[model samples]
Target: GESVGLHLPTLSVQEGDNSIINCAYSNSASDYFIWYKQESGKGPQFIIDIRSNMDKRQGQRVTVLLNKTVKHLSLQIAATQPGDSAVYFCAERPGNMLTFGGGTRLMVKP
Candidate 1:
């Protein structure tokens, strides 16, 4: 079976603050998880990744927390800015295939 969908997106926050988004997955065998950010009319850019063997990983101004038991992941962005406003996606890379979740839009109030 195939898995993918589209949904409305909206996130508004004050500038220089932080933001967090959540995701849920159905596949338990998935091993790798990645967070990506995409701007208007662009492809998803890699932000960070975490393996199923671990529970947490952090990157510049970003952190990813994974819960293997629940099949969930989350991304935290520090110092949200106007330039940071964009759509964020979470992808699960199992084997040679990459499965993407519907993105969430982030808005930074200036």
Candidate 2:
């Protein structure tokens, strides 16, 4: 049995536009955070990650921001594309286990 969690559910964006996905975590002791993108029928793929010591980090076309003060995390995608359409999830690593958010579905309208 899994505990209840928070999630956004879905998000829609226009192609070529930027997309912002937000997440909230409960563990104040979490030190590592990761963002993943999951396509239909596929496993969650790594997007970007940030540490509790850092406020922000960036990847190829993605950026992850962590606000430990508010226990919040956010991901920003540049030039949203149809190929980018997927479910995005945030994970917090507390100790040796990882807890994941419900996820946000990103739809890119072409």
lDDT (tens digit, per residue) of candidate 1 on 1-110: 44422243677889999988888877777889888899999988899999999899989999999988877788889998788899988888767998888888898999
Alpha-carbon error at 56 in model 1, in Å? 0.8
**Residue pairs that clash (backbone atoms under 3 angstroms), model 1:** none
Question: Over the stretch 7-49, how does candidate 2's per-residue lDDT look in tens digits?
Answer: 5788989999999999988888888999889999999998888
Candidate 2 global lDDT: 0.87
Question: What is the C-alpha local distance difference test score of each model?
Answer: 0.83, 0.87
Predicted structure with the largest TM-score when compared to the true one: 2
* Best prediction by lDDT: 2
lDDT of 1 at 50: 95
Task: Report backbone clashes per prediction.
Answer: 0, 0
Residue 97 displacement (Å), model 2:
1.3
